[model samples]
Every structure is written in structure tokens, then in C-alpha cells.
Target chain A: MSLLRLALANLFASWLTSVVNVLLLALGTASIAILLLANAQLSSALSRNAAGIDLVIGAKGSPLQLVLAGVYHADVPPGNISSAEIERWQGHPRIASAIPLSLGDSFRGFRVIGTVPAFASLYDAQIADGRIWRRPFEAVIGSRMAAVTGLAVGDSFAGVHGLSDDGERHEESRYQIVGVFESTNTVLDGLIVTSTESVWLMHSRHAAESAPHQDGVASHDHEAVQHDHEAKAHAHEAKQQERDQGQLHNSVIRHGDDITLLLIEFSSPIAALTLPREINAETNLQAASPPYEITRLLQIVGVGLNWLNAFAGSLVIGAALSIFAALYASLRARRHDLAVMRCLGATRGELFNLLFVEGLLLTIAGIGVGLAFAHGGIELLSVWWGKGQAISVSGWIWAESEYVLVFGLLLAGAVAAMLPAWQAYSADVARTLSAP
Target chain B: MTAEKNRVLQVEDLEFHYDQPLINIAKFDVARHECVGLIGPSGCGKTTFIHLIAGLLQPIRGHIQINGVDLSQLSERETDRLRGRYMGVVFQRLHLIPSVSVIDNLLLAQRFSRTKVDRSYAVNLLEELGIAALKEKKPSQLSQGQAQRVAIARSLAHRPALVVADEPTSALDDGNAADAMRLMRTLTAHADAGLVIVTHDQRVRREVDRVVNLGDVA
Candidate 1:
């Protein structure tokens, strides 16, 4: 009925070539879209989780690992620092708030963080059920942890000694589940929180039980011959008393001193410039800036993503070339048909527009299919990775760059069809119409 | 005087050249409902003469007036528009877009001519041509005779004042050629339009009312 309809009909008549062009373009567009969505989500998740906390102070080791362990909880902590050292910096004039974290235990793959109530407030997490931990052995679980482990109020579970589930279990220290925190859509949602005293209690009891035993002789009220045995027993008792005193000393040291890292915020911007330097210079602790370390991590990841984007871009160019080749070749075969149209009184411009419309229709359909593929890919990624890390991958996230990409693809299609359309417009109608 | 006013085409001092002169016609004219045949040997510019009259080629020197409007004075776009509205061409090769159905091909003619498509009129025309049942069939599916009939139906779909057939029956057998010529002449007369058949087919030459030899004119 119309030129557009005629164009559509012709495309469908050559459905195989059209489908191949659309699929190639769709695949390229989907890959670029997936990359953009994933990169944006990764950057935002990193920034959101690292909010409020400006610096992390831990044992001198890999600064990146320290940030990863202390802030993101994605890796093992560098090492432990003494609580006395943390307390010494806690009251500094430049410090706004400092919360000490004691790590090294887990419940069902989720890290059990030993910190105070302020840690929960750092993530804006509230008690969704019951209450926060009120005692040394009571635990408050994160929303994700609670849902995954099915641990509710008044439930009790034993903690494993390390970050992984296969670590040694402390059967003696059973922690009662006191509360569950609401989902913060951050790393906080995958944590089991308790007081630092609880971690100290569990490890100290294990240490005391594993201590070396002193040899002893049994004494009886016999005679002077049993005096040697009595002397050995008295000696053993003295050794035992010394061992108990040493154990008490060790318990006191462990209970008051050990913590994994310090999550710190500055009262003023001046502290950011001075505190990390001062702490690293004056003390054995290593000061790591979360923002600097996270930026470095993303820069490293961005290189690989850039390569993938370039690959997808090349694929788009290839698809455009294919479209051009197909249309140009088809034009050669349809010369007589074009001539017939001319004889029917179609102008050169109308013939050119028909090809242009055909190319545009293919590109638009391909883009639509490609967008659907991108959203489906993101949804799959959310299910596979987001749940474990408490990252939300839901919602439509359209980027301005994608609009630019759509325009570029449409332009590419137009350019591809330009030559063939021109040929169709300038076809020698008289010669073609007279051909046998 | 009324008959002179009904003249569909008039040509005077028409001369066209491509490398050399292909056509030099002193005078030609066709009145309404008139049927004329243009006969020529092979390579004698029979098709070239048709192209010149159809506004597809500009004459080196000529005045071609269709319905008394001089084509040489019109712009290229206006000439195309005039041709779309006032002229129909049936090519030697019977060119129908192989992708579309017969009815759509006819509709396409109206579309290109910027005229309102009357489906019932197309159906009536096809039925009169005895190929109404093949309206939905693609050109490739139709027989050669059916394809040629479809081409004729498309050309006349907009009811042009003049229908030009360039070797319309050259590919047919003797019997089929005579039938095609008869059908084209009858259809053009029924539509109240003049017909011009440029061909070397003797059977077609006998079917028209008048014959002009291109070799003699050149």
C-alpha cells in the first residue's frame, strides 16, 4: 500500500539475510549494554558500601587486602592489632568515631563480626526482629544471614573458628540469636554481629584447654620413704599454680588487646590529611584510605572492561559492514525491479527512501532485542552473584551512553544503506526495462 | 474541433541522441481511444522513442505535448509526476516486482502515481483481463502470459490517458502474441485511453488501427 510497507515486505521476502544482520547487531549491542550496566552497578555498590568510613587501620600488610577485609568483607584480614593501640588513637582530637572489629569466625560462610552496636548504625541497619546482642554470647544476625541460615530469635548456634565454614567449631561457646537486622543492601546484610568479648572468650577457652600439662606423682600417708613422692607432688602443685597464673595473664592480655582492624572517620578534613600519616609514622599500625584503595581496585578492573568494550565495538562495526554488503548485493539483483518501479512513476527519491527505511527497521528491531538480552543477562547475574554480596541488581538503569550508542548504530545503518540506495535511485530504467 | 481537443499525445520535431542520434521523428499524434503500432527492425531505437515520449529521456530537440501540455517546459520532478498521472508503460520484459502479489503490484502503481488506490477497480480490471483469480499470487508463481497481463493491469490501474507498450508480446508465441495484442487493445479502449505498441511482431502490427515504421521516420 505504501513505500514503507513495500520495504517491510521486501525485507521479509529476503528474511534470511535480514535475520542474520539483526542477530549480529543485536549480539553486539547486548554485550555493550551488559558491560555498561555491570560497570555502573559495580561502581555504585563499591561507593555505597564504602560510605561514612574514611580510613581503615590494621596490621602492616597489603593495604588493598586490609580495605577488602575491613570494608567490603571480600577477603581475609591482613592481621590483627592490639586493642590498646586502638584505644590510644580512639580519643585523638582528629578522630570523630572509631569502631574496632574482631574477625576470624563465621556462621555458614557469612563472617561473624565482633563489634559494638555502632557498627550496625554505620550501615543504617535496624533490628528487624527482637533486639541487638545484650550479652557476650548472644548474636544479632544480618537480614541475609538470617534468611540463609534460618536462624531466628532464641535460636542458638556454635561459631566456627575461621572465616570459612569448614574451620574448627567452638562447641563450648554457643551463641544465642538475639535479633536480625533489616536488609541494608550492603555488606552489612551478610554479617553475624556480636560483641568483641565473645570472640575473645571463645579463643581464650580453646587456648587454655590446649595448654601443656605438668607431670605429677600421687602421695599417700605411708612413712619417710613416701617423702620423695610428697616432694614431687609439692613441686607439681607449684608448677600448676605458676601455669594458672600464666594462663590468667594470657587471658587478660588476649581479652583486652586483640582486634582485627579499626574502621575510622575523621571529625574534620584536616584529620584525613594528617591522621593516616601520623598513625603509620608513629605506630606499627598501617593506615589505609578506603577511597584511594577502592579507586585503585576499580582502575585495575576498568582496563579489562575497556578491552571487552572495544571487542564489542568491533563486532558492531562488523555487523554494519555485513548489512552494507547484503544491501549492496541485493541492489544489484533488484535492478530490474527498481526499473519497474521507475516505470510505474516512482521517483528516484522514493526508491532511495525505500532502502533507507528497510535498513532503519532492521536496526531498530535489533536494538530492541539487544536491550532485552542485556536486562535478562543482568537479572541472571543478580541471581548468581548479587544475593551472596547483598548487592541489588534490580531496576532499570538506562545510561546516556546507551542513547549515544543507539544513535551511532542507527547512523551506521544509514551509512551502510547509502550507497545501495543511491544506486537504486540512479538506476537506468530504460535499459533495465528493455532487457530480455 | 472536439476530436482535436481529445488528442492524448502530440510530438513535433522530436530528436534524441546517445553518442549518435537514436530517434528523429518529424510528427506523431494519438487521439483518445486510438491504437497505433510502431514497427522497426532490431536496434532501430523503437524502445528509445518510447522512453523519450515517456519522459524517461530528454530529447536533444523536441516538443512533446501530452494532453496539450509541453513536456519540455516542465521540471524533471514535474515531468515524472505527469508521467505517473497521465501515462502507463508496459515493458518488453513484463517487469512485476517478484516479491509482491499481483494486486499489490497494481496498488503500487497508484501509490507511485500519488493517486487514491481503488481496490474494486483493480479487481474489476483484473477480472476483465481474465486473471482476477491470480490477484494474490506472486509474479513468479504466475505463467508468462499471466505475468504480462498483470503488468498491463498495473500500468492502467491509475487510468492514465495514454498507455505505451514497448514490445509487450515479443516473448510470446505467435498465438499468444496475437491474444496479448488483442487484450491490450481492448483493455486500453475500454479504459478510454490511447494505446501505442512499439514492437517488431507482425501479429501485433496487424492488431492495431495504424502502424508507423521507426526506420522510415528516422
Candidate 2:
């Protein structure tokens, strides 16, 4: 056996100790790798979903909640704002675009949003099938939501009264699927898009049906007039009337009627400075900057990620020390063999390399197993997190940061080996060999 | 080549110091193809003297040469290289690498000594030692006598010019010890190397060409 092979063999001779050291290292490396992958995905999803829409204007509550509700559609909005108030910001000189969203009902836990077609274009959304909604009560669902719900063009589904599937179904107000969006990998992928008028119509029908009947669910059953030829005819009639009533519905926005929020863009950097302040101060609505709120949210979450990084870093350090202890103890047991090697004409450097290479082998094996385990961990999380989710997590992404982690971990391993190697290097060969 | 024709080992006016002067030899020499025995009572600095001869310890005042190369003139690093290339030391413990197979043990000696790793020659040495079939066995798997044979095979792997053994047959029964002494004599003669053996046993005296008492040297 060459000295390298001797190092490898020595480790194998104490195979149980070697395996324990390797497992500790793998566990540490895996944790670091997982942190790197997960953090990158979280950052990408946060920034990508918040692109283009500079500010979110909604009811005054948590500015974070306003951004989460209006930008992400992941939380309840504070409340709705009056349409006259929405019209106040619509044609303002500082405003580039003010897309209104009316949120109330959901289908199968996917939000059925009331918005203009500009909302889809805001995400650079492309149609994957059929066409965009042209009238009230016709919906174009996000591709991911479409796949999950199994909704196709011409299929009709009624809105649920709340955000969750367990909510009361608004059976009187059925919206037909007109189109499906391409998977944008953005927040838009989890939503169903219909015009603001469809939201008003769904609420109006629900109100009309619920007013007279004590059992609101019995008054408009979910199992009626769905996909029948008569239902199609009735849908066709409703579409024609809604096309005529589009302008009339604009005037129907009274002092009592309200829409959810406005996602506003800036005409200039000057408008970004003025508009959010003007809306928040002069008007009774909150305007939260999407970039500002997202950064704040990430900073809050960054603290937790930092803790996890520290925990993983400590684990790596612990693994390094464990390896050091194993090598050190093995050196004590092999001192006689080492003295014999010296007598056999192995130089101090050769003996040093023997123990050093053992640590080196353990480090390489641990790093290799750790990286693989980390990537596998990310894959499991991706599966548990579900595909095409808002977070867009993946295990296969190879970041430069992971390479940096490997380099750092390798350095830690080298340091762990240095003590035993130094011991081997400076051992008094004659004295050791002469000992009984 | 000239050094090989002269003597394999030489020592004159040697003094080795530890906390005290443990070794002080006035004159010693091993001619080409000779077997020499070092017999002394326990605690007579026999191991210390051998270690100094091997360049594992430096003499405070002495001239020691292996194959006519001066140990004092060379750096400790070069001395180590010299020792590996020209000599094989068989310790009392027979320190073969415990996890490696017997054949690999010989290869390691050649590798550390910077000699050409000759597997066929290693196998031949094991054959001469009569442990050829045990070539693939680990040191842990070898019997005590078989382990001694493997150690002898490893020391003679590159056919060094000088061979040193420390109490090689002390732990063996008389039958195994006699067998070991016969093999040592046969192998040293086959390689034409000078041999030095340290022992406290009187039974070891008849196997060598000359005897040196460490008490008389001191």
C-alpha cells in the first residue's frame, strides 16, 4: 500500500469511527446546501412576483397586508374602497396606470379576482388556451389553477363566498371559463380573472338570492343548470345583456358600492415620490410601495434564515471537530505503527500526509454526500411545497453560493486534520521505536 | 558501487545522549555478507545503539556510515532517505501495517524507501520465507511466526544492503525461534547483505558470524 492507500486503509480499519465522522459531515453540508437553495428561491419568487407594480393602494391597515393582498393575493384585504375614490386616481397625471381589483369570491381555494385585462398584461401574462373574458361572468383562469381545478373552456363554475373551499357557494352567480393563462410562475398563476363587473354581478346575485330565503344555500343550489344546452343559451343571453350594461354598471358605482384596491404604476421617479404620500395623506386609502414592503418582509424573514444559517454553520463546525477527534484518537492508537513506519524509512512529511489524507478523504466523502443530500432535501421540499407554487422552489438550481460553501467546508476539514498531521510530522521516531 | 564493495555498516567513537549517555560504542563494523549479533543484558542500550546506527538517533560524538555514506554529513531528511534505501529494520514487535495484506506490506516498504515497487520480487521474497500462500492475509490474520516471516519479507523487499533485527525471536517458542534464525541466515546470504541482530537470549549466539556485548563496548 502506498501512503495514500495506507491512509484510506487506516480509516477503513476503524470503519465505524470513519462512518460516524462522514455522517456528521454529510448532515452539516446538507443543511447548508438546503439553506442556500431555499433562500435563493424565496428571494426570486418575492422579487419576480412584485415586478412592474410600483405601489399598492388599498384600505388603511397594515401596509404589509395591503402589499400582500393587492400584490400577492395571499391575504385578506383590509376592506374595499369606493369606486369614486378609485376614479380619483385613475387619470391623475402622476399615475402611469391604476388597475382596480375587486376581491371577494373564490373557486376551489383559488381567488376569483375582479380586474381589468390590464391586470393580466401587467404580469406579461399570455393566453395558453381559448380567449380572454369579453363580458361579465366569463373567467380566464391562471394555467396552474386551471390544471388543478380541471376547468376547460366553456365549463362553468360558481364562486364560493370566501377565500377557502369550505365557504358558502354563491350558486346563483355562475361564471363560464373563457380562457386559461400561460404559467407565468408569478402570483397571477393562482388566480381566476374576470372583469370588475363580474365581481359586482356575483355579489348582486348573491345578495338578491340571500335576502328573501332563510336558507341561502337552499335558495340557489350548486347543482343546477350547469353545462346544459339551456344553460349555454342562458349564458349567451346574459353575455349580450352584460355587453350593453357595461356602461350602465359604471354609473351603478354609488357612494355605498366599493371595489377592493388599485395596483398603481408611476409615470416617473417623481411620481413614486409624490403619489403614495398623496394617496395615503390626502385620500383615506393606504398606498404601500411594493418594493419597500417586500424588502421589509424579506428583512424580517432574513433574521430567521440567518438563525438557520448559524445553526447549520455550527453543525458544520461540530462535524469538523468530530472528524478531528476521530483522527486524533486513531493517531494515538497507531503511534507504534507510525514509529515502525519511521524505522521503515518513511520521512516525517510522508507520515504527516498519511493522517492528513485520512482527514482529506473523510472531508471529500462528507462533502459529496452532504451536497447530494442537500439537493435531495430541496427536491423533497419542492414536492411537499407543490409544483408551480408562488415560491417556485427547486432543488436542481446550482448556485455559485453552494460552490463557496463547499470551499469553506473544505477549509474547515483541512484545519481539522492539521493537528494530527503536525503530530505525525514532529514525532520523535527513535524514542518511539525504542519504547517497549 | 564502491561503497557496496567495502562494508555495509561502520561505527567508530560513537556516543548517543538522551537524558544521559545511553550509548557509547568505541568501534563497530559489518563487512560485506556478514551476520553479526548484539547480545547484552536488558537495559544495556542495545536498542539505542541500533537506533543510532540506523540514523533514527544522532550521535553526540561519532562517525557512523551505512554502505560507506556518512550519517553525520547528511541532513536528517537525507539520512532517512539513506536508511530507507540501504537498510531494513525489523522491530521486536514486527510492525507490519495491521490492516494491509502481507503483499501490500512489502509494496509499502518499497514505496517508502523510494525503491522500484517490484511485486514479483516481493512474491519471491515471501516464497523464500515460506509464507507465499499467506501473501493476501492481513497482519491481524497471521500467526505470530507467520507475522515474523512477513516482517522479514517486508524488510528485505528492495534487497537492502544492510538488515537490522531487534529481539526478533524473543517472543517465539524455541522451534519457531530456530526456524526464524535459519530463515534469517538463508535470506541474508541470498541477498548478500550485512545483518545486525540485538538479542538478550543466549540461544541466538550460534546463528551469527560474530557477537558484540554492549557492556564491553561501553
Candidate 3:
């Protein structure tokens, strides 16, 4: 048998030892893989969601926190900017659209985002299932919220108090789920979307409870008119009057002049470049170009990842050292075997060959098994998490970095085995042979 | 005969020690094509002498030359090369490699040795040693006699100038030991190599050209 085959056979003979060695390597590599994969996806998602928007005008705060809260809808908006103040910028010469955001509530940790239809357009969001919100108090749900809440078209539900369950209640204003949006694979998927007026009205209900449940009555009347065609003629004029009363109260309380953030799109590159500095100086508000801010965020995260990767690499080196020890320890036990081979005219190099081959074979086998296990684990995680969402979780395991990790782990194993191979080469054949 | 052609091993003023003081030897030599038996009781330095001859242990004060190359003057690399190319060994325990098959054990001999092997000759040697059928078996699978035959076959696989079989028949039964001795002698004779078999077994003492007893040496 060839030295490699012989070494492999030896490794196979001690199945438990080899498995433990391989498993350690696999665990170390896989943990590193998951950390890297998750970070890359986070970075990718950030860049993808921030693609169309040129700049964000938000209340002065941490720029990264603002991006997380404003564009992603993943966190609470930093603070409110007067909607009236935002409206002044809506029709500016350089402005394309000013999407105002109103946020104060959540459904099961998912933020309920109150915004105009420009919110959808800004992220290239489409309604793959039903339609976008057209009326106040009628909500269009994001893909993840739709899947998690199991809310279909026309299903009505009330939002929980605040982002958490313990916040003060808004019992006066209940919402009807008008549509379920398709998966966008963006942070928008983790939200409930409604018009800015509806969000204000919900808060208004909290402020003035006894003020003639105006919008609630209008929506109830609208639903009733849908069932009976004969009542349609009678209800049409009544519905209009109710709608007018609802709007009059909402406008009086409509803090739409105060917005948490403004996602700005520009028709020209020059306008986009000059707008941030102009807005930053013009008012107390801050403007951030998302791509630049995101790049900076990634740089901070990248340093952490490099240190983590080095840690993982060092653990792998430790595993290699363990393999070296296992082989070295096995050498004395194999002395009789060596001596016999020497008597048969086996040279020192051949003895070394046997040991080296054994080390390499053990490493290769462990790496192969570990990589396969890691790949399968990643695939399983993706499939489980991908249910009812546009976000593909399977991309993590198949990424370029995963391939590099596998190659790197195998290389480390080879280098580990070389030390003991040299020791076996210079072994004292006569003494070892005669040892009892 | 040419000066290089007749000499297999030459030793002069060989001395060695363990925890004790040194035992000096004035001169000793073995010619090519000779089978010499080193007979001595326990702790009498026969194995130590063979170790020196095999280039495994160096003498405190002497030189050992195998074929024409003086091992004392050789570097570790050259010593290793000489050992690989010119010497073969059979331990008292017949230290057969346990992991490989008997055939692979034979093949391993060529890995370090300078001598080119003939597989057919190896097969013939195994056949002569009555281990041809057991060539694919591991050392652990063979009987003591069979394993020793494999060891002898391995030593002769490279056709080295000297074969030092230390206490070669020590572990075998009387019948098996006799068989081992006869087989080793026949094989080394056919290979035309010098054979130094170190053992205290007086039963097989008559088969060698000369019996040097370490008990009577000093």
C-alpha cells in the first residue's frame, strides 16, 4: 500500500480519535463561517436598501442609528421633525419626493411604519399579494409581517401598545389590513405600513378619546356599504359627510408637520451632492448620504470581523497542533512497526513517509467531513428561515468566503502534520526495534 | 580478491558502556559470505556489539567499517545512508511493522536503502522462507516463526553486504528456532552477505563458521 493509503487506513482504525479531531476543526470553521456570513448579509442588505435614496434628513442623532431607524424600519425613529418643516422642502427645486415617516407603535416587535406611498417607491417596494394603503386607518402590511401575523386582505386587527407590549394603549383607533405586500428582502418586510394620517389619528385617539370616534365610524360605514348594493345610494352621501368630520378633527391635531426623518431623492447628481450640506446648515436637522454612512458602518464592522477571523484561524492552528500531538504520541506505540519495516529494508524516509502520510490523510478526511457538515447546516438554517419571505438565507453557505474558509482549513491541517513526519524520519531504528 | 570485494565489516578497538565502565575490544572483523554467531549469556555485550556493527550505536573508542566505508568517519547523514543502503537488521523480537501487510513490510525496506530490490527475488525469498502465502498478512497475524522469517526476508530484500540479526532465535521454540536459524543462514548464503547472528542459544551454535562467545572474550 502507498504511504498515504496506509496512513489513511491507520486513521480509519481509530475512528473515535479521527472523528473528534475532525469535529473540532469543523466546529471552529463553521462558527467562523456563520459569523462571517451573517455580517456579509447584513452589509449587503444595508447597501441594497439604501440604493435609490440619495440622502436622509433626520433629527440630529447618531448617523448609523438614524439609518437603522429611518431607512430600515428596524428600530424606533430617533425623534420627530415637524411635518410642516418637512413640507417646506417637499417642493424645493432640487427635491424629487419627500417621504414623511410617522412611527410610534409595533405589532409583535415589528415596527408599524406610517408613511405616504413614496415610502414604497423609495425602496422599490411592490405589492406582490394585494395592494398598497389608500385610505386612513387601512394598513398595507410588509411581507414578513403578513407571514408572521397571518393577516390576509381585509383582515382587521388592533396594534399593540408601543414597540413593546407594556406601553400605553391606543384603543380608539383600530386598523384593517387591506393588503399584504410581497417580500422585498429589505428591512421594510419587518413592518406594518399605513398612511401618515392614520398614524397621527391613532396617536390623536390617545390624546382625545371622547372626540367623536370619527375615522372609526367612517371606516365602519364604508365596510357596511360594501355588503348591500341597495344601501349604496343611501350610504354614499352619509359616508362623505362622515369622512369630512374625520378629516376636520385629524387636521387640527395632524402633527404631520413633524416627521422623524425625510428620505430624499434627487433628479440630478449635482442636487444630491449639494443638498446635504445645505440642509445641515439651514436648519438644526442633519442630512446623511446613506451609501457613505453605510460604508463607514461597514468599516467598523469589518475590523471586528477581521479580529474574529484571526481568532478562528488561531483555533484551527490549535486543532492542527492537537493532530500533531496525536501523531507524535502514536509514534512510540508504532516503534515496533517501524523496526520491523526497517529490518525488511524500509528506509528512514519511508518510515517518515508513513507518518507524514498518516497526518495528511487524517487532516484531509477531517476537513472534508467538516466542510460537508457546515454546508448542510447552513442550508438547513436558510430553508427554515426563508419561509414566506423574499430574503434568501441560503446565500450564506454558498458565498465566496465559505469556499476560501474550506481551503484555508485544509491548508492548516497539512502544515500541522509536517512536524511529526520529520521526527519519524530521524528515529533511532535499532533502539526502537529492540524495545520491548 | 579486491580489497573492497572481500571485506564486509571491520572493527578495531571497539569499546562501549551503559551505566557501567567500558569494555574494550582490540580488533574484530567479518568477511563477505561468512555466517558468524555471537554467543554470550545475558549482559555480555553481544547485542551491543551487533548494535555497533549495524551503525545503530557508536563505540566509545573504535571504528566500524562496513563494506569499505568507515562508519566512524561518516556524518549522521552518511551513517543513515550507509545503514539504509548496506545494512539489514533482525531484532530479538522480530520487530515487524504492525500496520502494514507482510508484503508492504518487505517493500518498505527499499525506501531508505541504496540497494535496488527485485520483487521477484523478494517473492522467491518469501517462498524460500515458507511465508509466501502469508505475505499479505500483518506481523500480528503471523506466528512467531513466520514473523521472524518475514524479518529475515526483509533484511535480505536489499542484498546488503552485512545482515546483523540480534538474538534472532531468542523468542522461538527449539524446533522453530532451528528452523529460523536454518532459513536465515540459507537466505544470507544465497545473497552472499556476511551474517552476524547474536544469540546465546548453544543448540544452533554448530551451524556457523565460527562461534565467538562474549563470555570468554574479556
Candidate 4:
């Protein structure tokens, strides 16, 4: 016989309306919750993967492609830049460090990257066992790569000839897994790291075998082989329009001494302003700032995100209206009940509490179910997504803005119920009782 | 003056109006344990008169008293408390919450009276009314006579000082009306509560101890 008990009974008495309102509110809340969590985690991972490197120096092409491929290993590298030219930039006063990424091959679906031991420092990477590659053809597998490929330390595997999974296998020089990089939750977790020499040796021998029967004879001098290899690689690339990108890529695996891109760090903030401009303008290679390209990418992507956010916001507004309509119609129908309660000695304030509490229950049930559904869905997606390998987005991270969303919607529910509650509060008992 | 001391409800120079005056009374009183019937034709403001006595409507002039407290002297909040604690009303159409059971309707009145919920007394009332088996049944499920009996139970559940019933027998056939009149009188007498029956039905005359004609307002 408590007012709350009475209110609860009233709410459940109209179970169909109550259920529909809860679902509408839940849909809106879940939509916004998913968007907020996805955006926050995606932005975090993107920024984390692109940490440290100020600029990416590569063959002249799209800066975004260079940044994506170079920093994230997510796309195709435009082509290659000469190591001698990169070495010259390494000596520049503004350039603090230069890490060369010599890309060309893959084992299973993961890329096998040829980089110096110092490349590990960019991510603060640690080797979990054994050691970094000491000799040519030795490799350190990333933790995720190790888990996926099931490659153990001291194991060897021959790589395919392209950046992708389906490529011509190169059996002449197999890479031995010398160590495993500890999980860093970055793009590095999906790559296999080795000395630049291993890539050079593999491609030169593969190219020698492609032109006839020159596979058995080994070349000892990197400088000599690179000089001869680039001449033929460029000649094949010039006619690349005749064939597809993947075939042309496999055909041009000529020199590992010529790297795909140079990851550059500036000595100071002034170097960031001056160095990329100098590198892009003064040389054949293009130097793209990772942060700049990432910002531009997000700006283009943000338009879509904003539209989706607006769509979700409209759902929230629609839900508020739904709850209002349900409550208003219910109170109008229950006017007699309101008058009866008044006649039974219930005060105006008590009547208001009764209706307001009804609104509050609907709002809370909707928000609670919506948040639970949103977070639960993301947790499941994370499992499936971790294996798919783009960037790691966790459901465990909660955005501060979701708290605001919940509070704001609760206030909206209160506003929606306000007029009807007031009508009930001001109901005339004598007139209501006499009405037929 | 001695009768005034025993009065459960007293009205003096009560005047209320909407455009033209709807209710005008010089004086009326229902002493303790009395059963008074106020008889009038339709639209004679019988319902309005009972509302004024129940403190649901404030008189434009003069005042009404319930349990010897001047209703006009009490705050609106206090008036509501007074109505819950000292006054009981049964309308032509019952106001039992259709969502809850018949027994729950009685408990609702008891709860609003700010009294401890007495479930045993509510069961006893239903028992006295011969609807104890229907205590858990919703109002919508009951027959009209059963529903009326539930309404009577609601009004007197809190043992109020005065009970006002509006057209309680108007909707019933003669047999049901007789049974309803008999129940209201006996129940109020058992609680030592004064009763006011407002009706257009002349058939209620023999059941009442006194009769007041509302058609004599002029």
C-alpha cells in the first residue's frame, strides 16, 4: 500500500507501453555508447601506433599511403628510396635518428619486416626470449605474430615474395626465428623483424632465379649487388602498368639494400617544421609527418562519425518523446485514479512523487540495459577483432562522456514527465468524483 | 449546544458557487452514530454538498467542521490529513484502483490515513461484508454488488469519524440497494461513525434515522 508499491503496480499494469518505452530508450543509449567507445579506442590505438616518428621518408607518392604502410604496416608501400640518400639525411643536424624499413615479403598473413635492432627502441619493444637477430636470415617474431604463425625461437620458415599473404614463395633463404618481441599492443605486434641484410639477400637471389638459372651462385658484396639490382628493378617497374601491382611487386624484388621507407625523428621542434619540407622538396623521396596525415585522415573520417553521432542523438530525442507520450496518455487515462488518491488523503507532493518515480524507473532500466548491451557487444567484438588485426580496441575502457549522456537523458525523462505529473498534482477531486 | 458537542460533522452558512451559487446551506449537523439521508433530485448539488462536508471544496462564505475542527482553519495539507483521518466518502462510481486487489484498496485508504496498516482488520471487514473469499480479486472481476460492498469497505476501513456516501444505491436494483443500505448502516454503527447518505432515491427514506431535503435549498 506504499505509494511506490502503488506506482509500481500502475506501471506494470500498462506493461506493453512500459516495455516499448524501455526498448526505445535502450536502443538510443546503446547506439551512442558503441560510438563513444569505438571512437575513443580507435583514436587511442592510432595515436599509440604512430608514436615517436616525426616524419616518414619514402618514394614520391601519397603521403597517407606512406604513413599507413610505413608506420602501421596497414597498406602498400609506394615503392622504395635509396639507402645512400636516407643515410645522407641521417647525418643532417636536424635528424636525430633514422630507422629504415626494408619491406618485400610475408610469412603466412603477417608481414616480414627487415629493420635494424634500433627500430625496437621506437616502440620501447622488449624481446621476451633469446635475442635480437645477430646474423643474416635470423628473425625476431612479434608476440602476436608468434602466436598466430606458431613460430618458436630457432625455427625457420621461407617467406613469400610480396607484401601480402598470397605471393610466390622464396625458398632460397629461410628466416630463423631468433627471438620474440613482447606484446606491445601496437602495429609491431603483427610484424616479423630482421636485419636489412636478410631481405637484401633473399630478394637478390630470388631476382637472379627469376631471369634464368642464376639461383645457386651467391653474391657477397651488398654494394655491388644493389647497384646491379636497382638497374633491373627500375626497368621492370617502368613497364609495371602492363601488369598488376602484386605481380610487378613480386617481379621487382631485386635489392634489400634499397629500403621501402625511412622513419625519421627530429632533433627539435624546429626540425619538424623545416626538415619534412626540405626532404620533400629537395629530394625525390617524399617526407610526410605521421601526426599531420593522421589528423587529416581523422578530419575526413570525422564527418561520417558526426553523422552517425547525430543519428544516435535523434534516437535519444525520439525515445524521450516516446516516454513522454506514454506517460501523458497514461496520466490522462488515470485522472480518476489521481482524484481518488487525493480523496484518500494522498497529498499533492505525494502524487508528484508517484508519477516522477515512474518516469525515473523507465529511464534507469533503459540506460542500464543499453550500457550493458553496448559494452558486452564490444567485448565480444574485441575477441574477433584481435584476430583480424587492424588496431586493438578494448571494451574495458569507459569514456567520461557516457556518464554525461546518462545524466542528461535522465534529466530529459524528468522533463518529459513534468507536465503530466503537475496535472495530476493539481487535479480537482470534487469535479472528478462527480463526472460520469 | 449539547448536540453540537456530539456532532461528527456540522455545516454553518455554507455557500459555494460557480457563476451562480451551486450550494447554499444555513446549518446542518450529523451527531455521533447517526444515519442522516440528504435527498434531492438530479443536479440539485447533492454531490457538491457532500464534497463541501468532506472538505474537498472550500466554501466561499462561512465554514464547515469535521470532528469539531473548523476545516477552513486548517491548511490545505492539514485538510487532506483530516479528510484521510476523520472523513470517508463513497461515490456513485467506486474509485477502487483497478490495478490492485479489493483488499489492497482498503489498505491503500488505511495507509493514507497515516495509520499502521492493519491487514487483519481489513480481512475482518471483507469477512463482515461476505467477500472474504474475494479479497485477492481485482475490482474489475467482481459483480456490481460485490464491487459496491468493496467500496463501502474502503470508506470505513480507517474507522473515520464521518462517512459520506454519494448515490450509493442509485445504480443498484431494489434488492441490491436494500442490501447496500443495510450494510452501510450496520457497518458505520459498528464503528461508532456518523453517516451521511446523499441520494435522489426516495427509497432510502425508510433506511435512515433522519432525512434532510437538499431540494429545499431556496
Candidate 2 segments whose C-alpha is farther than 4 A from its true place? A82-95, A121-124, A208-258, A302-307, A388-392, B1-4
Q: Give the lowest summed-lDDT range of ten residues in model 1 chain A.
A: A218-227
Highest-DockQ candidate: 2
Misplaced by over 4 Å in model 3 are: A52-54, A58-66, A75-212, A215-261, A265-325, A336-368, A389-391, A395-435, B2-6, B12-33, B60-63, B114-124, B214-218
Candidate 3 residue-wise lDDT, A184-283, digit = tens = 7787777788877666555544433422444222111012111111222233334434753553222222322344678887867898668888988888
lDDT measured at residue A237 in model 3 versus the true structure, 0 to 100? 34
Comparing 1 with 2 on TM-score, the higher-scoring candidate is 2
Model 4 per-residue lDDT at A98: 85
> What lDDT would each prediction earn against the true structure?
0.82, 0.83, 0.71, 0.83
Select the stronger candidate by lDDT from 2 and 3. 2
Model 4: residues with Cα > 4 Å off, grouped in runs: A84-97, A121-132, A153-155, A211-256, A265-271, A282-284, A383-386, A394-396, B1-6, B173-175, B190-192, B216-218
Question: On TM-score, who's better, 2 or 3?
Answer: 2
Error of 1 at B134 (Å): 2.6
lDDT tens per residue, model 4, B24-71:
888888988899999877877888888787778888998798989999
Q: Give the per-residue lDDT of model 4 (tens digit) for A22-56.
A: 99999999999999988888888888888889999
Q: DockQ each candidate and list the results.
A: 0.65, 0.72, 0.30, 0.68
Docking class of 4: medium
Measured against the true structure, the TM-scores of the candidates, in listed sequence, are 0.87, 0.88, 0.69, 0.86
What interface RMSD does candidate 4 have?
A: 0.9
Clashes of each: 1, 0, 17, 0
